[model samples]
Target: MKKKPKLLKKNEGLNPAAAAPKIEPIVVPINKALAIRVVLMAGLVVLKT
Candidate 1:
């Protein structure tokens, strides 16, 4: 007879792999860089005048 895998009922912390939350990578858009530079330049121009 084949043996079955033991079920984890009482000890939840025993499984480290399943307990961890999945992390997804967040990416920023490239166009945002240009917008930031424009805003900073406008601030500097206002400050200089």
Candidate 2:
């Protein structure tokens, strides 16, 4: 029983390690897009002023 739980824990750990790289690529693009939009909006505001 203890061995089974240890194996499960290792699998669970690996799952996130595998998933984290996938998630970061997706998140980074979103952040870059948001930053780009913010910069554009700021530029527009400056132009309007």
Candidate 3:
């Protein structure tokens, strides 16, 4: 038999550091690279629909 994972209640802090929400930083490429990627993705979506 497998043990169930422990569930933590909202606003319930067992450990201050652990209880805090961890945020990951977004990675953005240079403007020129980003523009090309966006244009390619848009073209793909248009073709798919």
The lDDT per prediction is 0.56, 0.89, 0.60
Candidate 1, residues 1-49: lDDT per residue as tens digits?
A: 2333334432434655554332212223445777799999999999999
What lDDT would candidate 1 get against the real structure? 0.56
Per-residue C-alpha lDDT of model 3 across residues 1-49, encoded as one tens digit per residue: 2333343543335665655443212223456678999999999999999
Consecutive 10-residue window with the lowest summed lDDT within model 1? 20-29
lDDT for each residue of candidate 2 in 1-49, tens digit (9 for 90 to 100): 7799988867766898776876799999999999999999999999999
Better of 1 and 3 by lDDT: 3
Provide TM-scores for the models: 0.41, 0.60, 0.40
Q: Top model by lDDT, which number?
A: 2
> Which residue runs does candidate 1 get wrong by more than 4 Å?
1-28
User: What is model 3's C-alpha RMSD?
Assistant: 8.3
lDDT of 1 at 28: 36
Point out where model 3 deviates above 4 Å. 1-29
